[model samples]
Target: MIRSGQRSWLGWLLSLGLVWFGSVTEATAQAVPQPHVKAELIAETTAIRPGTPVWVAIRLELEEHWHTYWRNPGDSGQPTSVKWTLPPGFTADDIQWPIPKRIEVSGLVGYGYETEALHLVRITPPADLPVGKPVTLAGKVKWLVCKEECIPGEAELKLVLPVTGDVPPPSTWTEAFSRARAQLPLATSEWKLGATVEGDAVVLLLSPPTPTEELTEASFFPFEELVIEGAEPQKLTRVKGGYVLRMTRSKVAENPPTRLAGVVVTPQGWRGAGTEPGLTVDVPVEPPTAFGDALTPTAGTTASKPSGGQPLGWMGLWLTLGGAFLGGLILNLMPCVLPVLSIKVLGFVEQSRAGRGQAWQHGLVFTAGVVLSFWALAGVLLALRAGGQQLGWGFQLQEPAFVAFLVAVLFVFGLVLFGVFEVGVGLTTVGGTAMNRAGLAGSFFTGVLATVVATPCTAPFMGSALGVALAQPTAIALLIFTALAIGMAAPYLVLAAAPQLLRFVPKPGPWMESFKQFMGFLLMGSVVWLLWVLGLEVGVDGLALMLGVIVLIGLGGWIWGRWGSYTYPALTRRIALATAGIIIVGSSVWGVSAIHQLPPVASAAATQPEAKSGSIRWEPFSPARVTELRRAGKPVFVDFTAAWCLSCKANERVALETAEVRAEIERRGIVMVKADWTNRDENITRALADFGRSGVPLYVFYPPNGNEPKVLPEVLTPGIVLEAFRETS
Candidate 1:
């Protein structure tokens, strides 16, 4: 209730009569002049209810692209703060802060806001205060707003509210207050969190109630200073069934704190979807321990070896092996491997007509080629990483020279397929040395080609294996790679060992020439894709030079086809071959040298905000829009289903289509949406991950009051949905 000392209706009438005199009652609470900003003090309540608390906020509306700081200003700025000058007998609590964005400018990293911000504080009044009179809440706010230049601004703001004995109406800022509250970090008990000091780094341990995604990025903004180097990246990785984020310690920290206090912000909310992205962290900091114990599996997850010196254990080893094998098998179907498919098929067909012994030999040679290629590639990658190159798989592809090389190789192969020219050996073993098409040498080279193309794709199930493999010693890493090679070559090995399977291949005839020519066109398609990749790597000028080099190669191929045949006289044929070699070599050398020197287009490209880095998905609802509404504390309902499923249609017609359920949804202020999964959608699959559901008919409800979102039963009825809607109230 409000202060009870008011003199009935007579005093209220007299105060209304003198409203124009000196009373400060007004619709808005604007501020003293501040350049580039509009500042004010506003209350969430229409009038102060004495003996109860009221939310008063310091509202700073900044100019476009300008920003103000958070509690910890990070590297080189001051945080926004306020000093209260309130009436006696009135008490004010400290400001309640919303999570801040990471701001980087001129190599300095800071935590702040970009636009309008509200610093909310709770004000509790005395019970004995007289009613029907206005109370002035004054605050002096000082802030540093920055773009390229930093400007400090100060303003004295006031909000006038009359003390009333009745329940007060919510002011216009009620919605804003709710939004600010939603932005505040949520304290959760779903994860058992702790911190450990690992040498110069701080390792945060989070044990979730269940397994979480393998996240690549996360931001931890510590409340305490000298805890972490804010500008450095916080590398997050999955361990067993939980997660760990290792961060660099600040140079100023002479000793570790008793506890690490901060907010862990992730767009795929720490407590999962439809919840606040900012999570409150206040866990004790302990001394370091080996991953074996610290990262022991809570359920099915365990701590990783982390480095090569330790063992990945039998369980980890098996998981890695299985994952690598599956990934390698999947690689054959990736775009990179498609160009060589037809050639391999033709070789297999040719082998079907050959002796079984020859086919077996060719298979063995091909397997050797693939295995050795992987060995060489993996060794180089491991060595570079050991030497601190900070590289990952496919690191070579980032080089323009490498891209150009791939383009040229694919183009030449395309020419071979199109009968532009012929090599003594093909990439696959076929009719042997007699046919001048493919030989044992060809089989080995084809395996090498397969390995090279397969590097570009990181297929499903490969992540856990490859990620762990690279962290191991050279020997262990190679073992994993060997498994991958064997998996990739498994199908070919099976065919080679059992020539009976090749009986399906037709005998060589007119169709053979047509088929070879068709395969050549397929290779050309691969060349086109490589050209596109080259254009991206090198700008337009570089692309033009590379195309010129390709044209020269094509000409050289034509020259060789014209005169290198035995039908030509010896001296003329020899000269033609030498000229073709010289042109091909010279043009390739010139083109690659020119392209590698060009600056990457990405350097000038605009940067996306760090928040959008994660692979967060929402099917029917836009991820950004849902995040926006969630941040504003709005209620939302999503039905993840497929039209092909009869149950979804039945539920829609019987429950959702009914006026009663529809009215309840609208009454709850819920934004209802549906995602059709009739056809496979990767986005829908990812959204389903939000609820830990793999398939459709999933229902989720986000309440307006900021409670953890609820996942309803897969089978929904009007009663269940109506009950879910009641949560919004």
Candidate 2:
């Protein structure tokens, strides 16, 4: 994921104009002492028949050690772009880039060639053009040239060609144009395509010997960025001796057509292919598990229709509502909600002797809090999605700052419930403290907090339901969210209406204090888990700071609890409060800043390999690299897993690590690749969603022939995994 920090307009303007322009130096046209950069056009002939395809190429000759950009100029460099001015009825297509080498220098990455490079464009002249007439094609080319530092350059290049009845075949540049065309990806017109939708992702199976084996060297560049992240390609694994590319729906995806368009790159060049598997969500699972069963097809299965587009009309809307209701009901059972529920239960018991109206009021207020929170969340998601931000459920976890803040908040609550802090005069239990002031509001806030914590654990049916809801119209999305809200609030609403349920609670006495304390421990446990997650994202240093903040906040709460008592002096109380405020503010700032500064972890431990092949060290999936290896006849196996994705971890521990699976793979001499999507990788996300999988724990086994692969089930067993390798072998 690329982080876009703040930048001023002036900085951007300079980057586009002077800074980028001034860096150019003619490489061949000028024999200057300074660095050289030259541009020229190569064409098959000066004259061609109108309506006949002509190869017009743009060539860039860079001096030693200097480079020009590829289509995907990685992290820092700018790609070479051209603007063509042609006569009426003349059209020019985009320039095709040759395979680029990965260049990393000074912690910057850019795809480019260090030496000579040629980009080809197909030109077609109008059939009505006058015979024997010449037309000049002019264009400005902009490119970023770099070694250690990047320099942007532009050059005006032109090509004069005649529109004649009979085209002249003899040309000095014909050989060069031929070579450039030869470099492009194998013509796909001869190859057959098969694909399947596993979940949110689409898995394309390319048959026969693809011109090249280096699938990693190839990029599946979807035409639309909003439909796919062009920068990141899901690693293509060689399964059953063939290739399987994992692709996803873009975070900012639109309602795409039946055919999803994209370009596939090999080491030699790029070829275009489109997959039109019918995409649809597995309908919501009711108590009786009513829904469309996931379309899991065997090998060589052809998709009858496209897999992704707008969601189901009204049917999806109702399903979403049903899911929301279920989610709401499940919220009460969540670990985060349990503590608050206990406190509410205790409060109800105390209010019973007073009046049922008050008890009912508290329940209503709690339900209101949960529903309101859900609505607010829906608003945020809708607003950000509308603003074109790539966001998902549990987006909060992506920010270490938010996670740290939550950790501190939970710590304080846990401490308070454990009797480390007291809120009301002569009150020990959390309910007593809240009841002393405004019980209903307190219950409401508790409900909101529960919802916030519950975002991470997307219940079983929630992902498919939510995914469908997200793609629907705003009204439908809202209805689904409301349904979930109703589901979550159902149990609480029932308890509120039936005041007699308060009798189920034990009398509020000494034992009640012990129960609250135990519940406090649970809350603290949750805090610890959140802190641990933060540590994984940022580092140990960040976690240490978070722990310190929790301790300081606890001390503050403890000191504040003693303020009205005869325990501490006025001056000491004031000092404690001031110290607590400072620590809280300081820690929050420090934690946020630390997270922002944290660089991505690039170590193997941090990066999970996509396919694990033999003992050969598994590398991160690259389209170009995969293509190269496959060209070399090396089989590839891709394992898409994640740290936070529960199913993935389970599969790794149980099935993947099994000796039988490993032995079978080793015996087959397959290359193992693990694509780690612990963090949000646009490539992986696109790949997953492309395969029709909303999430991870995906396993695709590639055999030696480069045919279709065998996809394993979500829950992998040793036997299943071993059999996959054996069958592929």
| Cα deviation of 19, candidate 2, in Å | 51
lDDT of 2: 0.59
Cα TM-score per model: 0.47, 0.50
Writing each residue's lDDT as its tens digit, candidate 2 over 265-349 gives 4433223332211111111112211112212222222211111222343454566567667655664554435434545554455
Q: Which segments of candidate 1 are over 4 A away from where they belong?
A: 1-309, 426-438, 603-729
User: How many steric clashes does model 2 contain?
Assistant: 94
* lDDT for position 108 in model 2: 48
Give candidates' CA RMSD values in order. 23.9, 19.4
Best by TM-score: 2
TM-score of 1: 0.47
* lDDT (Cα, tens digit) per residue for candidate 1, span 146-194: 9999999998888888877766767777899999998988887577788
